[model samples]
Target chain A: MKKFINAVDNVLGESLDGFAAAHADLVTLGAERKFVRRRELNRSKVALISGGGSGHEPLHAGFVGHGMLDAACPGQVFTSPTPDQIVEAAQAVAGDAGVLFIVKNYAGDRMNFEMAAEIAEGRTATIVTDDDVAVEKSTYSIGRRGVAGTLIVEKIVGAAAEKGADLATCVALGERVNARTRSMGVALTSCTVPAAGTPTFALGEDEMEMGVGIHGEPGRRRVKLAQADAIASEMTTAIADDLAAPAGSEALLLVNGFGGTPTIELYLMYNAARRMLEQRGLRIARSLVGSYVTSLDMAGCSLTVSLLDAETTALWDAPVRTAALKW
Target chain B: MKKFINAVDNVLGESLDGFAAAHADLVTLGAERKFVRRRELNRSKVALISGGGSGHEPLHAGFVGHGMLDAACPGQVFTSPTPDQIVEAAQAVAGDAGVLFIVKNYAGDRMNFEMAAEIAEGRTATIVTDDDVAVEKSTYSIGRRGVAGTLIVEKIVGAAAEKGADLATCVALGERVNARTRSMGVALTSCTVPAAGTPTFALGEDEMEMGVGIHGEPGRRRVKLAQADAIASEMTTAIADDLAAPAGSEALLLVNGFGGTPTIELYLMYNAARRMLEQRGLRIARSLVGSYVTSLDMAGCSLTVSLLDAETTALWDAPVRTAALKW
Candidate 1:
C-alpha cells in the first residue's frame, strides 16, 4: 500500500503518462491509448510489437526504439492488453515490410495479440514464447509462463528486423531464439496489487516460494527460505537442465531481478549461477545481470539461459537504442 | 534480513567477482583486490577514478567504460573503501596526463580517496562533490552528502576526459557540474544492511522520512506518507529552490529509485516533478530515469537536477559505453 501511485484505479494511465513524459525524446503515445511506440518510427521497416501487463516497466515500452520493438501495448497491472491497442500500434508502425507480434504464452495475451494481428493492416506473424521452465501450467496460462527469455527473444528478433529482415524472417528468428532459451523464478514474498491494497497471496515470515509466476500467483510450492547459494543453485540448475545445452556450448546467462531485489543481491545471484555453469562445462560466453524483467515489488529473482551461436550472439551484441536494453 | 547476498562478510568480494565476471568484456578486476577498471585503458587520456561503499551498484563499477570512470574501488557493504584499494586503482589507470579522483563528501570516502591521491604515482587531483540539498550536514558527512549527483558528475567529467581534456580541466569541469547540481530524497522504509541483519530505523505504517540519506540514516523528520503528487512537489520544489534554477534554463532530470521501489512509482514521481518544473518554466533538456543509484532494499526515491547550459548538455549527450549508463 506504500506505492507512489496517485490512485489505484489510475495506475495504468498515470504511469504511462509519466513514462511518455520522461522518455519524450525516445517514445510517444500511440493514436490509441495504452499504446507506446518509438517517436522516430520508420514506416519502411518491419515493425516489431510486443506487450503484456503494466507492472513490468521498461519491458515492452522501454524496449521501444532503434533496433527494437516499434510499439508496445501496456495493459493494467497483471492484466492482458486489449486487441484495439495492439491493432492501432501495428497500423501506425506497419509499412510495406509488414509487422510481427511477439506474444508471451498467456491465454489472454495470446488471444488478444492474435486477434489484433488478424484485424490489423498488412501481413503479420505471431510467435508465442513459453520459456518458463518452472511449471507447465499456471493460474493464467495452460502452457509455460513466458518470463525473462522474452527479453532475449526481443533483442535477437529486433536486431533481425533492424537489418531489413522480412516479417517471416523475424518470426522465424523469434521462434528459433525462444526454442534455445528457458527461464525459472523464485519469490521471497508476494507483490500487492495497487487496486487490491493487499498481497496477492500470503506466506509465513520464514517461508519462500519457488517457481513463482510474474503475477504473484502460486509457484511450485512454498517452503522455508534457504541460503543464497542454495537458492541460486536450485534456480540455475533448473534453467540449465531445461536448456540441456551441450558441453562447450556458449550462452547468455540473464539474471533478472523480479522487482524489489537489489543490484547487490542480483550480482550475488550471478556469482552463484556462474559457479554452477562453470562446473558443468558450459562455456559462459556473455551475461546480463539486472532487473530486466520483474514481478512488481516481489522480493525474488529469476534466471534465463539463451544458448547462443555466432549468429544470435552477434545479434545480441548489435547496437540497440532503447530505454531499457541498450548496448 | 531478506537479501540475495551469499554471506554478510563476503558480500563485497562475491559481488565484485560477479561484476568482473558479468562485464569481463568491458571491465576487469585490477590486479589489486577490489579495484574495477575498464578493459581498454588508454595511457594518453586523463584517468577518472571513483570509489566508495559497495551497496551502490551501477554507480562506479557500472559506469567504468568509454565515457565514464576509468576505474572504481568498491568497499564492503555500506562502508568506505580502504586507501590501499583506491591507491591501487589510481596507479593502474593513471595515464600520461595523470589521474583525477572523484570523491563523495563522506568522512571515510573523502579521507581514503584523499590519502590514495597523495600516494599514487603521477599527478593526481581530487574533486569532492557535495550536492545533496537535503541537509548541510549528515551522520556520515561533515558538509553536504554526495548523493545521486555523483552519477552526474562522473558522466560529465568522464566525457570531458574522453575528449582528451587535461587533468586540471577534468577536475574543474567536475567541480563545476557539482556546483550546478542539487538532490533530495525521501524514504518510506529503512534498508537493512546484510551484516547488520536489521532495519536501520523504524517508522509507522503510514509514516515516511523526508530528506533521508542514501545510507538509511535519520532525515530531517518523519511524517505521514503523502500522495505521489504532494511528495513530488515537496522534493522537486526543495531542489528547485535550492538551485535557484532560472525560469528559462534547461536542466537534466535524474529520477533515481532506491533499490526496492518499483518503476511505476518512480514514473509517478517523475510525472509529478515534471509538472512542477514546467510550472516554474524550466525546460528538461535531458533525463536519465531509472535505478542508477540505490540503497539496498530501501523503498524510496531521490531526484537530481543538473542545470545545464549548451556546453554541459552536449557533454551529457556524448556517447559513453558502460554497463549501466550509455548514450
Candidate 2:
C-alpha cells in the first residue's frame, strides 16, 4: 500500500508526537506516549476520558480540551490499549469530581477500560457505548459496535461535565446520550492497515459493504453500488426506525466520512440524509458533517441520528475548545 | 467511479445546499446558489471575496464567515466560476469599505475574476495567489498554479480586513503573504471526476507524482515511491530554497491532505515536515494539519510554508469562525 508512514510500529508514536506538537497549545502527550491530556486540567470538573484504536482520529484525542475529554489513551492501529496506559491516564487527569470512562462496546475495549477502572484510585465509573444499529453482535464486539455516535456522546456529555456535573451525573448523561443515538455506515472501498500492507477486504467494482464497522469488519451484507439518495434512504430509514423517536422530535444529523471520502461528498450525503430524515418526521435541529471518526483510509461515510431534548441540544450548542472541534 | 453523488450536474448544487444547511449559523447561500456569504455581514469592514472551481472545498466557501471572506462563489467541479457569479457575489457583500477579490493564479479564474471586477460597481481590489513552487508554468496556468497557500492568504488578509483594513491595505497584505508563502504537492493516486467517470491520471503500483498540481496535473517529476522522510526532505528543501527566508525567520507550517489521505498519515507527514523545516533553521511559530484545501478524491498531500512577521502572526492567531476552521 502507498501510505505516508515510516514504520508500522512507529505509526502511533510518531503521529502522536506530531499531534502534540501541532496542538501544543491545547494538549500534552504523556510520558512513553501513554496518553493525550488537556494542557490545563480543570480540578473541579469531572474528568471524561475515552479512547480506542488509533485509526478513528479526532475522536477521543481531538476532543480533549475545555469542553470535552480530559484525556485519551490511544492503542496501536485496530488494537486496544493496555490497562497500564488507561490507569496512568486516569491518574493524571482524574480530579475531585472523579473520572468517567467513555468507551465503545467492543469486547477488547470494554475489558481493558474496566480493568483500568478497577486498578485506578479514587471514584471512577464507565459508560460503554453501543449505538451502532447495524448488528447486535459482530466479530470484535458482543453488542452493537459504537460508531460515529461516540462523537455526539463525547460532545454533549462532555459539555455537561464541563459545567461541573458530578461523576454520577456525567455517567447518567453519557449513557442517556448513547441510548438516544444510533449510527450506520457503508464502505465503498476497504482500508489498508499499515502493517498488513494490503486492503482488509476486497469487493467487485460495483459493490459496497452496508453497515460496515470502523475497523473494516464485515457489515450486514454486500450490495450493488447505488445512488447517493438510495443509500441515504436505506441508512436513514434503519437509523430512524431503530431510534423510534416521536414524530416531529428534534434531532442531530451527523454525516461522518471513513477517512477517504471527500468533504464535498460528505456534504452531499448530508443533504440526502437530511431530506430523508425530514421525510421521516424528524426535525434536524443540529448537524455535523465531516470525517471525525475515520477507519484508516476507507472510502465511505456513516449517518448518525441522535434524538435530542432541550438539555442535550443546549449542551451540544455550548462552547467548546478542542483540537479538531472549537467554536 | 465510486462516490456519494447523484448526477454529475447536481454535485455542486446539492453539496452547497448541505453546506449552507450545516453552517446556517455562520453563512447563507445566495439566490440561485451563485455564492455563499456570511450570515451576518459587517457593512463597515472591507468585504473579502474569493471563488474558484468547486472540488477544493473548505477553501473558498468553507472560509466564508466571520474574520474571513464575506462571500465566496463556487463554479462547477474543476471549472472556474463565471463572471456573473463573481459580480453577483460582489453586489451581495460589497459595503462602504468596498470589496477585495482573492483570486487564484489560474487562467480561467484570473480572467473571470478580472471581468467581474470591471463590471462590479465598487472600490474593488485583487490579490492573485501564485504560491506553488513546483513549476513555473503548468497545464492550467501561465505561471505557477496557486495551491494550498491560498488558504493562508485568505486567513491572514481576512483577519486584517475584519479589523477594518482598507481596500489598499488588504490588497498589499494579501500580496505580501502570497509572496512569502510557498507550497508543493505529491499525489499517490489520481482523482476521478464524476463527469469523466475515470481517474484523471494513472500511476504504477510503486510510482508517485511529486509536486503534483491540485487538479492532478503533471508535477515536477514522476519517481518511484520513496519513504516518508525522503519525500518530506525533497519537498521541504524545494520550498525552503525557493523561499530563502532568514535562518531564524518565524514560519507557519501547514500539511494539507488531498481529500483521500487519512488524518493519521497527515499528522505523520506534519511530523516529518516539521523536523525538516526545523533542520533548515526556521522557527515554526504556527501549525495547521488537516484537509482544508483538497482535490476531489485524490490520495495525496501538500505542504505549505508562509513566513510570519509580528503583524501577520497576530492576525493568524485572531479569532475567526468558518464552517471548516474556527478558533
Candidate 3:
C-alpha cells in the first residue's frame, strides 16, 4: 500500500508526536504516547475521557479540549487500547468533580474501559455509544457499532461537562444524546492498513458496501454503485426510520467523510441527505459536513442524524477549541 | 471513476447549494450561482474577491466570510471561470472602499480576472500569486504556478482589509505576502475528474510525482516512492531554498493535503516539515495543517512556508469565521 509512513510499527507513534506538536497549545501527549489530554484542566469540572482504535482520527484525540474530551486514549489502528493506558489517562486528568468514560460499543474497547474504571480512582462512570444503525452485530461489536454519531455524543456531552456538570449528569447527557442519534455509512473503496499493507477488503470499482462499519467491517450488503442521491436516500432512510422522531422535529445533520472523500462531494452528499430528511418532515436545524470521524483512507461517507431538543441544540452551539475543531 | 456525484455538470451547483445551506449564517450565494459572498458585508472595508477552478475547494469559496474574501467565484472543475462571473461578483460585493482581486497566476485565471477588473465598476486593484517553485512555467501558467501559498496571501491580506486597509495598501500587502511565500507538492496517486471519468495522470504502484501541481500536472520528476521523511526533505528544501528567509526568521509552515491523504499522514508530514524548517534556523512561529487547498481526490500533500514579520504575524492571528476555517 502507498502511504506516507516511515515504518508500519511506528505510524501511530510518529503521527501522535506530530499531532501533539502541531496542536501543542490545545493538547498534550500522555507519557509513552498512551493518551492525549487537554493542556489545561479545570479542577472543578468533571473530566470526559473517550477513545478507541487510532484510525478514526479527529474523533477521540482531536476532540480533546475546552468543550470536548478531557483525555483520549488511542489504541493501535483498529485495536483496543490496553486497560493500563485508560487507567493512566484517568489518573492524569480526573478532577474533584469526577470522571466519565465515553466508550464506543466495541467488545475490546468496552472491556478495556470497564477494567480501567474499576481500577482508577474517583467517581467514574461509563457511557457506551452504539448509534450506528447499519447492523445489529459486526465483526468486533455485539450490537450496533458506534460510528460517526459518536462525534455528536462527545460534542454535546462535552459541552455539558465544560459547564461544570457532575459525573452523573454528564453520563446521563451522553447516553441521552447517543440514543437520539443514528448513523449509516457507504464505502466506495476499502482502506489499507499499514501493518497489513493491503486493503481491509476488496470492493469492485462498480460496487459499494452499504452501511459499512468504521473499521471497514462487512456491512448490510454490497450493491452496484448508485448516484449520490440514491445513496443518500438509503442512508438517510435507515437513520430517520430508526430514530423515529416525530414529524417536524428539529435535527442536526452530519455528512462525515471516511478519510478519502473530498469536501465538495461531502457537501453534495449533505445536500442530498438534507433533502431526504426534509422530505421526512424533519427540520435540519443545524448541519456539519466534513471528515471528522474517518476510517483511514477509505473512500466513503457517513450520514448521521441526531434529534435535537432545545438543550441539546444550545449545547451543540457552545464554544469549542481543539485540534480539528475550533470556534 | 467512483465519486459521490449525481451528474458531472451539477457537481458545482449542488455542492454550492449545500455549502450555502450549511454556512447560511456566514455567507450567501449570488444570483445564477455566480459567486459566494459574505452574508454580512462591511461597506467600510475594502472587499477582497478571489476565484479559480472549482476542484481546489475551500481555497477561494471556503475562504469567503468575515476576515477573508468578501466574494469568491467558482469555475468548472480545473477550468477558469468566465469574465462575466468575475465581473458580476465584483459588482455584487464591491463596497465604498472598493474591491481588490486576488488572482492565482494561471493563464486563464489571470486573463479572466484582468478582463473583469477592466469591466468592473469602482476603484479596483489586483494581486497575482505565483508561489509554486516546482517549475518556472507549466501547462496552465507562465511563471511559477500558484499553489497552496495563495491561501496564506488571502488570509494575511484579508485580515488587513478587514482592518480597513485602503485598496492600494491591500494590494501592496498582498503582493508582499505572495513574494515571501513558496510551496511544493508531491502526488502518490492521480485524482479523477468527473467529466473525464479517468485519472488525471497515471503513476506506477512504486512511483510518485515530486513537486507536483495541485491539478496533478507533471512535477520536477517521477521517482521511486520514498519514506515520509525523505519526501518531506525534498519538498521542504525546494521551498526553503526559494523562500531564502534570513536565519532565525519567523515563518508559518503549512502542510496541505491533496484531498485524499488522511489527517494522520498530513500531521506526520507537518512534523517532518517542522524539523526541516528548524534545521534551517527558521522559527516556526505559526503553523496551519490540513487539506485547505486540494486537487480533487489526489493522494498527496504540499508544503508551504511563508516568512512572517510582526505585522503579518498579527494579521494571521486575526479572527476568521468561514466554513472550512474558524477561530
Best by lDDT: 2
Candidate 2 docking classification: high
Give the clashing pairs for model 3: none
- In the range B1-327, model 3's lDDT, one tens digit per residue, is 999999998999999999999899999999989999999978888989999998898788999989889999999998888889989988888878998999888888999998888888898899999889887555643788888999999999999999989999999999999999999999999999888999978899999998888876767899999999999999889888888888999999999999999988988898888998999999998988889999999999999999999999999999999888888
lDDT by residue (tens digit), candidate 1, A49-168:
999987887787889999989999998898999989898888788899988889888888999998887788788889888899888545544878888899999999999899988888
RMSD to the true structure for each prediction, in A, is 1.8, 1.5, 1.6
Q: Candidate order by DockQ, highest to lowest?
A: 2, 3, 1
Q: What is the lDDT of residue B110 in candidate 1?
A: 90
Question: What's model 3's TM-score?
Answer: 0.98
Residue B68 miss distance in model 3 (angstroms): 0.7
What is the C-alpha local distance difference test score of each model? 0.86, 0.92, 0.90
Looking at model 1, residue A115 earns an lDDT score of 83
Instruction: State which docking tier applies to candidate 3.
Output: high
Interface RMSD of each: 1.1, 0.6, 0.7
lDDT of 2 by residue, B150-232 (tens): 99999999999999999999999999999999999999889988899999888898999998878767677999998888889
Q: Residue-wise lDDT of candidate 1 within B91-119, one digit each (tens)?
A: 77887898898988888899888778777
Model 3 bad stretches (over 4 Å): A137-141, B137-141
Query: Which regions in candidate 2 have their CA more than 4 angstroms from the true location?
Result: A137-141, B137-141
> What DockQ does model 1 achieve?
0.73
